[model samples]
Target: MKPQHPSVRRISECFLKPDIECLPQESKQPYYLSHWDLNLLPIQYIQKGLLFRKPSEAFEDGHPFMATLLHRLKRSLSSALFHFYPLSGRLASIINEHQASILVYVDCVNTPGAKFTHAALDLTISHLLSPVDVPLVVHSLFDPDLHTAVNYDGHTLPLLSIQVTELLDGIFIGSSFNHSIGDGTSHWNFFKTWSEIFQSLPPDGDDIVSISRPPIRKRWFPDGHGPIINLPFTHSDQFKIRFKAPELRERIFHFTKESIAALKAKANAECGSEEISSFQAMSALVWRSITRARRQPQNQITICRMVANNRAKLEVPTSEDYFGNVITTLKVSAKAGEVVEGGLGWAAWKLHEAVVDNTKEKFREAVEQWFECPCTFRLDQIFVTNSLSMTSSPKFNIYGNEFGMGKAVAVRSGCANKFDGKVSSYPGYEGGGSVDLEIALFPHNMANLEADSEFMSAVSSPPHLFHQ
Candidate 1:
């Protein structure tokens, strides 16, 4: 049945630049894109949002309330940008004099500012949480126009666009960032900082407190890798088709501390090793269930690609505040029959080994190998066949983001960069080893996977209904 919810309608739009102009002496040249950033050039923008119950102090949702919100948000965001100034800039590129290389950079000098939008939705928190699957309307909470736009689109569009939506009894802060500018670490860092600043404001005064983690503008490069890596294409027209993402049904599976602990224990017992982490056990269960759901041929190969962070493994230690992508993908494969019949523990042990092999030396080698040909990730790798990939980390403090409102009621993602077999995991609101796995799969596979008894046994849902 069609979701019984109101459509979102845009009300206002504006740019929020740095509150204080940066000094030219302090100003600098264009910030070059790292090879890690370039590898995601074909990917779509990262559009995600944090939902909150309506603020405790009640006021009419008329122009006065929204107008005040727009004013305060713009101010707080502008202040936040002073530290994360690159987000306010536009994407700029220049072809070398020899015309052999195309260099992409962020024009920090211009400081184009992040986009802030105000929209209205006559929907309630209940409308979102009651659904078995995420309501389709939830996707539109972020701007609809940029839903499928790739990362390179940052050249013409605002590098960062945030939509502050007013719901019937809640608010949704939807953010869309240029994927090349940052990964989930950089993304949430900005949000967490903004929240801190927003909460510190005194409604009328702008005494923004210092943020916990400031942006670290240093982009990482492996030794011998070019500080000035060039794109093969001279013109933007040639940088196309990173890969097409498939539209799939998405469902959020909640694994409480108890459920995850049990899954981990079982996995360790089966492998005769107590080292299987909760994440690996959960991944194994999901992978095995998904393979069963697809009903692939017995001998068909299936792969699980997990994104690993390189902040600690960088040739040099990278602060978590570094404002760019610093991660790589790790893959584990087995035939469909082997994965399905191996039992959760056996499959999890395989995953544990993959994680252990991702050492600092191994990461440096991968970076060097990339410079050899220099290519971005493609869909055929993990999405086109009996394969799946995981991104985002449960360790991220997404639930802690509070912009004067209470802690986030839930975490959600937009439609961009999503495809069949893509999974995003978050630390469950209840915390303490709990996890929320947002899995995307072919519509048929989703239905079948949900029916798998072994999978459903550890799953919990219907996110606790919100109260303002």
Candidate 2:
């Protein structure tokens, strides 16, 4: 093993006295939980990989690397909050009440001699799951004891008792995290930071740069807010739904930067309007896809809600990298049939109008007003569009999320079980040339969606998009 870097040592020491003040405070209202407080639970799941013969041989000296990794983990674990530590009885209680709290275990099988590589892990996980629960933690309340872990089967290093099956030899690091901590980006940032520290590398200097503070105690509802309606849980009755499917429930698609530019030009030409954004273009594609899947009439007023982070727009500087939710939702409604009939360019223009047209202040005001009342509002679907630049090695290093093994293949937001649909976008594979989209819809809806030719063609076409 290599010596721990000076900076890495400093980071390990810092966790020993983690600044609680750095974490956001929970509001007093019954349901007004801070993103930090809600996502504090840590659920553990495992990621497995294979080790090469040479690397295995190099570790012939009795499990020394395992000991060192454990030592560092113990030190770091001691520094952070112990709230996520599962109480034997409490864990059972949660399992009984919210059966959905069951953790998801993902296995990444690699060929032997396959050293653990960051890019491979990213691709594997990206192809497997979206960061579903990570994003939900921003808005939902969570108990502690949420985490994921990985278990290794074969190895030359005796980290743990290596139990081999007929197939592969590799490492499994259990990933445990509280959903309420932060968005997928924030969680990935933490994992990347941990990995860098483990590898004895300097943490990215700009990674921890400060952003605006979030408004802590604003009244969400000043005047009397009224008639909050809770939508029925369409698929809640079927709790046995599998996490991944032979065919995905929702398809993820992307458009290249150039493609988006071309779409905008086409939209302008057709609608006699100004240029639109990539987000709008993508949204238009999805809206059309959904309508085609549902075969709904043109007059149906379908709604598309876009999720926007309000950290920068707030009066105070929000903790940009803070672990909890700091987002507000905005809705755009159009006749479903009209959108599909009007063509992708028209729908894209509508989406653009809904997004860029809104003032920053309007978003702030909407957030303030939401908290003014105690109403629990729900929506049909949400779309999260962000730059993939976030996951780049220099910008954010998820590969460094070392729990003993190496980094994760994919880190995604929680599945959208609460609503009719959920969608998220990450940076495209190569640079910022394109984007990767993940969509989650009700299972039945997903089945209907997969059979649609138009939707399938769009997904399989030039840019390429599909459900994970």
Candidate 3:
């Protein structure tokens, strides 16, 4: 379902670079999908927010401020897309002669440019900053859905869709991409480059190199890799997932530098491990709190799973611009009773151990092993396995995305992701040791989690106030 906003209006729609001659169609390149990319289902969108300058700038020659700003953004974006052309391409699968298997690869030949839209809402920045949870208008800023192989109709949808919305105080820049292309790091890499173009187009004319570099096409294929396994996805299957307005609530909980330090101290003291990281401590606390709130049986086992990036962990040398998915999941399990009864350090140790176990060599070995027996790893399949899934990396420079105007005042996950037990994390908008946590859960479970004594004790007051 699409989000309806009374004041929202579309200004214009155009390809990133309308001039076809400027970007000649290059020879078709067949890029094979990695093991990580093939296993995960493509259902989610990677939405990012960028805050721009205020509307108070005096219009030179009395021209409208929004019109000038939109023109500038579109021009800069076109330049950026010229370098990142693969992003404008679509993903397609080549069927085998047996019709029993498919070869999934990104189709970069004869593809159209990315989709860019200019839009505005009749709202002020105050309306967005005042909400503890991100306002719904933010979700409506970009296209609501992500492109999937099942729904790909040759040339219907572009791989990327960028929307720039003008607000009373500042502008909202949002980009939605299919999750198959890249993970959070790759997504931020593109944003940072686009921002560089926005600030100043490179003098060399080829903005790709100086502007975060073009994506590396060298595929990562291991020995003994199995054939691609196809999953059954029907047209009606997309509609199977539905939710009502009252089903869940999305909220951002802020953990300040002081609070996180204190939590770290408590967890470290309890576990007696000096190597425990902030992510481990925080994730443990969240997992324990949610399990307690759910009031599950004491004997039940609660699992915590996080998508770990394998870029740096890989044995082979990957360029800084190596794009596409390079991530695998790390799972930690503990009895509900232990998580609820144990100190923060106990839970932190389990998580930290699980994370540390996946070293560079370990990741390569795992990928090679998965090739022996490839299977569809769907997100919904986690319920049967029983785990709390986490996406996005806290290390990502999400708030540091300065696009000439200024750094974003706040950042958030999309509201469409307000599903039970899903967690997304970003660096605090304030850019301190703090962390911003976006949690989506059922209304009653959210209420219980918020009311958890230990959890609230670590939550900062007023929830990290957003500032310009």
Candidate ranking (TM-score, best to worst)? 1, 3, 2
The model with the greatest TM-score is 1
Per-residue error (Å), model 2, residue 158: 30
- Local error of candidate 2 at residue 301 (angstroms): 2.2
**Shift of residue 460 alpha carbon in model 3, Å:** 1.3
Best by lDDT: 1
TM-score each candidate.
0.94, 0.53, 0.87
CA deviation > 4 Å runs, candidate 1: 1-4, 23-27, 59-64, 97-99, 202-209, 242-247, 380-382
Candidate 3 lDDT score at position 68: 61
The 10-residue segment of model 3 with minimum total lDDT is: 146-155
In terms of lDDT, model 2 sits at 0.37
Error of 1 at 71 (Å): 2.0
Better by lDDT, candidate 3 or 2? 3
lDDT of 2 by residue, 19-93 (tens): 333333321112223322222222111111121111243256575754454455433332222111110001101
Question: Cα-based RMSD of the predictions, in order?
Answer: 2.2, 13.7, 4.0
Please give the clash total of every predicted structure, in order.
Answer: 1, 60, 0
lDDT of each: 0.82, 0.37, 0.68
Ranking by lDDT: 1, 3, 2
